[model samples]
Target: MAKSKKKQQTGPDIRAFFDSMDALASEKGLGKDEIMEIFRGSLITSYQRKYGPDARIEVTLDSETPAIGVSVHKQIVEEVEDPSLEITVAEAKKHREDAAAGEELVIEEEPFAFSRIGATNVRHIFFQRLKEQEREIIYNEFSHKEGELITGQFLRWRDREVVYVDLGRAEGVLPRREQIPRERFHPGDRIKAVIKSVELRREKSRDPGPYILLSRAAPEFVRRLFEQEIPEIYDGVVEIMDIVRDAGFRSKLLVRSNRSDVDPVGACVGIKGVRIQSIVRELGNERIDIVNYSPEPAELIANAISPARVAEVRADSGTKEALVLVPDDQLRLAQGPDNKNVKLAARLTGFRLIVKSLTQFGEEMSSPEARAQLEQLFSPKTEEGAGEDGDYTPLTELPGLSGRLISLLEQSGVKSVEDLVELEPEELEALEGIGKTTATQILKILEDVVSFEEV
Candidate 1:
């Protein structure tokens, strides 16, 4: 009767272990069924190692009480060649008279108390199995999140080469190459990055942890950030048309509004620059230009050179080239420091932009001798129209001549058709916006318009 009473108490202790597991599952946001599955496998391994491979083990959680049950399997045989695999037939008959040879039987025994070494081994196996299962859960949870932005706390450096981030359920890695150059990370700092990839290593020798790769240097990172901060973008009212980046230095994004009422640039910039500022802060304060996308090449080129006021945009659609004219005083601003503005604008628009000052245009337009040569080439057939106005007024009437170019000709002192005929194509190409092809085109046009009589 005392043994019976002691066995009753052991059941309660076993039940308590299951209760603890349930509480842990609830606290950690893990499923109870998953925890139980892992617990079962751990117990089987531990029991087999401690006792024998054929040791009977049945694991169950008490619903009314918090406890677990582990039953060992014992078999009866005529002779015991393997003690772990069989028991004496006579002894088995004492417990079960119906037991026979080759008949395996399960024996319910009181929960065995583990020794110090056994207990430690059980714990190590349990936790190791639990961690592996948890890693699998985390990988499954986050594998679908590629190309999405996730926020995490900065953890520690690995191999002094990779930055580790503490995601809620798993650790994520931001390799040195994936990080923006010159960016620093410290423990406990909150950061955001895009999930680049997730690798699962299931080898028996490996730790079984997921290889999570993250990135902050990708252009898609910027796009995803805007999608988060800008409501219009998330709702699909605005679309990012193109992205041109210089990595850490700067990026230009071209966005267009899907709805007529929506202002794409204004939406991305947000009120008081709040939306883009959030992104800028994350990217180590990289400069960003949010330009409104335009279907017209001329308008798009003008927008691409933002902060540089453009007087006019003359585009050669055939050659995909544009000449942007700015005021004389704005030339420095148009070109930016070391011509950064023009360089970025060219990348953004995918066009060769020649930024010229208004002064340069005036010089190309106002040459008097150049005008006389043009007038003689297209001479007035009627005497009635001939007058002291040199029979030709504004040079802009020519197909390729803009008002700015006419002003440029006059400024250079080429006052008549004779002087224009003498000018060389190489001299014309030296102008800021005029390339070799444009210079050749202009020379051909001038030659066709100027007559020898006018010269």
Candidate 2:
């Protein structure tokens, strides 16, 4: 049997480019017209770079075909001072019957037809622009997905054991530290992760491109998983108040339901515990506690220490401090081994919590000094010299702060007055250009300036 002859491909190869452009536009959600406009500019740029930018040029696309045409508009003069940009009235009349001196003459031409270097420049411009447009399309697509759950294909592992997942349009990196230890990914496996951030990452001598940093270990990842699993959470019926997790180990999820009849915890738990069980399996059997959220901090703290009986809780809203009392035998359970239970509760509640047995609470209350110390703890810790809202003050707005001090503060990552408040005198002295005397001066100026404002 004779082999079928392959038909020879012919016509302006530029048509193939337009076809490819459409395909990429469809896939990347890019505008075809915008890309073609960029390509036209690039062609003109390549022509200018090669042919001394003396001639004014206009580029137009043929309506009937994919071919691009270039026209050099030259001044029709009596004498051609520069052949590239000026044409004699006699030469202009060859294209136009009534061409006259001082009139503009249009010379229809193709770019890079005469020089090899010009052709090479055009080729380079095409590829460079193509790469840039691709980067922009990817960045625009993924930037909107920051802090969102995305499904991706597992590609391969790279430096530091980070897994690169193909997120359809862009690649996302799941750093080893941000990956769940209990989970493993294989090539072609469908994996789900949360996009922690989208940022431009540059390597040596390479164009910076936006990359997605993904995570499965973040607390938000578990929250997103619950959002995916439970319809009530996805809709407006239920809301997640807070979530805290120790990836691949345990997680605490607090939820509230809008409807009085619906239990937020039960909605997440599902019938026969199927909903939470599915999420637990996805997390490699990580234990999840679905709890009802209470606006009251004491009640919330009490709920957080569930499975362990709490006798009472005293919470001060101002100081964000809390003291929990449990029965003597239940104290160990409330605190758990290594104080893991109380620590998780504190993180979830955003409260400084102290877990004590009922007996210890009574004994502490029995002493006058101890009682006085507890009262002090209940009051807000006052900043000695800083403004109550110094955190809102920019470094440049601080009184008595010199340009040199501002530069140093910027270098040390202290951009505002609040950052300075976080540092001790010793820590301030540890800065590159700061001495003990300078540290003391900075503190004194801060105190005096903020105090004067108050007065």
Candidate 3:
């Protein structure tokens, strides 16, 4: 039987192609050293694909210039049998006179002609490898930057749903779901977008930088804009407690001052609304209402529903609910065109807000039929001591309630947790040593505490 021979796959030597060092460095923001390393690794991979997998190869790339060289490493032998892997001592000595039988010899040469179809394939393979490298670099950069702000040029539109941005070293996508529906970003316009996500793409995405996802609609974007536009917020004198947006048309920002003298809302709005105006322009003239954040839930919610003064706000701690009273004329503004304002205010304040006109609030307060309706609308099974629950725990059992708070509760004749739940926020604040902070904390504690028996 004849000995079977192994077939070898060879490709065109694309090393002859010159890739401008400046072009590569500019594309990835990589220095010459990094580019050379990438080139060497790419050559080794290309060489292995062209030659057999077991073929021994050594590749070198010029660190200071765009030059690459590859060599096949073969052992010097007294009598060569496999010419591809072994060189006769006499033949090795022709190049390196010190060559010995056991020593290795490196022959500098191109494995295939540059004009061969294999060369084109090798070039394509090399560039594809570079693309993967670039993907890794950009992915690493954006992954740590998710939710961070990035400014780039609007590249183009795609499918009428996505916008592409040219971030110097990588491309980013503004998916339709992340775009502001009311804001139009034109080609070549400069944009500042928030990094929504960064991941290694498995399937081909519609735009470049398939691994990058940017967002203009994220609430974080509005927060970032506020941070960028407001000097006091950036300086930490004013803090943004929370922000909620209707995405395109409007946004609500809750800001509070750390110092007693600095007005958070005033600082955010700047003198005559200059700072917020800059942010509003960036958001395509989106209406932004900067409201003061208070430790008091009712006050915060009342403020969140700006342009509509609240006659009174009644909050239920255990239910995490609030009743918002507005003048009949302001009811439309409080609830917006379709309850949009109240809905956003609820989100910003973390409450289930019930908005109503003052007349309606009064009717419920004074009318018997209205009282029954209110009872039906807001009624829930109350705990036993108050007459509706089978199980109950004392207010002292509230978690994280300091001894001082418990002492105050006990002194106030609050024997059971149910009794504490019935006190309004102002009543809680009025207790000795229970300031606004302690009152807020107490309300939160009660909101989540279930009776020991129920637990």
Query: Which candidate has the top score in TM-score?
Result: 2
Question: How much is the lDDT of residue 199 in candidate 1?
Answer: 77
TM per candidate comes to: 0.60, 0.70, 0.68
Task: Show the lowest summed lDDT stretch of 10 residues, model 2.
Answer: 1-10
Per-residue lDDT of candidate 1, residues 1-455 (tens digit): 00111233246655667678889788766898877777778777787875588766676545565445665566667898776667777766765677777677665444356678877877888788777777777889889998899999999987877898998878898998889889888877997999999978775733356878899988888989899988999999999988876668777899999999988989898889987887898888988989898889999999988876889988765445677888877888777654667777887888767677877766655898755653453453446755435533445545776666666676776544434544556667776666687778777877677543211
Clashing pairs in 2: none
| Decreasing TM-score order of the candidates | 2, 3, 1
Look at candidate 2 and tell me the lDDT of residue 61: 60
Output the worst ten-in-a-row residue range by lDDT, candidate 1.
1-10
Q: For candidate 1, report its TM-score.
A: 0.60
Q: Rank the candidates by lDDT, best first.
A: 2, 1, 3
lDDT (Cα atoms) of all candidates against the true structure: 0.74, 0.77, 0.74
Model 3 deviation from the true structure expressed as Cα RMSD, one decimal place: 13.4
Worst 10 residues of 3 by lDDT: 1-10
| Residue lDDT tens for model 2, 1-455 | 11112223234676776787678667756688876777687777876654357767778764246566776677888987776687787777776778888778666665535388777777778767777777877888888888899999998977648888888768888888898885778889888889998876553433267778899999999989988999999996898988887677678888889999888988999889987887887788877877679989999999887658899999988767788889999988787654667767878898867788888878878999878767766655567743434314687777788999989877988877856764657779999888898888899988877531101
Off by over 4 Å in 1: 1-12, 47-57, 63-67, 72-98, 109-118, 157-161, 185-188, 201-208, 270-275, 296-302, 305-455
- Cα error of candidate 3 at position 425, Å: 34
